[model samples]
Target: MTEPLIELKGVSKSFGSHKVLDNVDLTIYRGEALGIIGPSGTGKSTILRIMAGLLAPDEGEIYVQGVRRDGLIEDGGDPVGIGMVFQQAALFDSLTVEENVGFLLYQNSKLPRSRIRELVKEKLEMVGLPGITNLYPAELSGGMRKRVSFARAIMSNPDNPSETPEVLLYDEPTAGLDPIASTVIEDLIRYLQSAQGVCGTYAVVTHQDSTIRRTSDRLVFLYEGKVQWQGTVSEIDSTEHPLIRQFISGNVHGPIQVAG
Candidate 1:
């Protein structure tokens, strides 16, 4: 069997005394899409942060392409190859789309300004926002901002040319968009996986059922700081797990408690 592109073993994290992730183990294979679904505050986003090396787990280990991740950059475990798309788009208000997409290249790469502009245009076109390089983030719609963020995440190549990022971490990619825009983001997610063929694997954290169903080849359900159930999207509809049933049906009762 092929080794997983990303793996988490007995991962546990806590914010003060509140335990968020408890002994979580997950594996993401190359060329596969993994969807993570859970109620709010269930550590779904925390998982993404940990995988991206943005936050360290109090316990357990994370391995990217078989390399163990530990400590800060000075200690040698820097967030080198990983690409992250935040939930809010997180674009710079002062910079134009071109600057936003090429921000990493400008900061990290020693490439000339002219070459960087050419590369930025190529990436913008890849995300379907070609010719809008001069537009500021405030000028574009919500969907367009998310696409710009997407373009930025993929702007850099890591040291290992053959293992470029290999993993894409997405936190709520479809949130705050209308139905039409949500669908567009969903299609773009799939397109990135199919067309670029560079990300190699991805893990998406979302609560939207349609987004989950349309994008995931595998599903993981989290609750009360741990995974409650896991299976394929097709298997989700047939699941007998009460938490899965309640979440999928949008039921207020059953295994999930809505706090007052």
Candidate 2:
């Protein structure tokens, strides 16, 4: 069998008094779309941060492509091009959408200004937000800003043509949007994962049932800072796992408790 693309072994993280993750072990394979789902604030976002090397676990280790490393994984260039679409869109209000999308290429890539702009425009069109390059983040709707963020995450570095980020990590891509906007983002996620062959592997951290059902082939449930269940999207309904059942049904009377 081929080695997994990413491995989290006995990973644990805490924020002062709050324990955010504990002994979280997850393995993500090549060319697969995986969703991490759970109740709100169950450390789903924190897990993405750890995976992106934004935060380090106090215990355990992170191994990329079966190699143990001290810092973020890097091969030919920048930290393995781990693209993360942040939960809040995280766009720069001062920059135009085009600038924000091509910021990395502008800074590190040897590609000319015109060529970089072309690439950024192409990515924007791919995300279904064509010809909005001149607008600022504040000028667009929430869903549009989120889509621009998606475009940024997938942009490759010209300096390291062979070093494009193989992994795309999304943290709540559909949160805080209306039903229609949420559907658009979910569909885009599926398109990028399945059609474009953009990234070798991608992981989504989300709470929406539609997102999990539509975008991922398999999923893992994170609860109380640890993964409690893992299964295919189809198995989610028939599983006897109490945590998963409560989560999917959004039940308040099960083993899982609603925070007051």
TM-score of each: 0.94, 0.94
Please give, for residues 119-222, the per-residue lDDT of candidate 2 as tens digits: 89989988999999999999999999999999999998656756577889999899899999999999898788765537768899988888888889889998
Task: Please report, as a residue range, the 10-residue window in candidate 2 with the lowest summed lDDT.
Answer: 72-81
At residue 231, what lDDT does model 2 achieve?
91
Q: What shift in Å separates residue 200 of candidate 2 from its native position after superposition?
A: 3.6
User: Which model scores highest in TM-score?
Assistant: 1
User: Whose lDDT is greatest here?
Assistant: 2
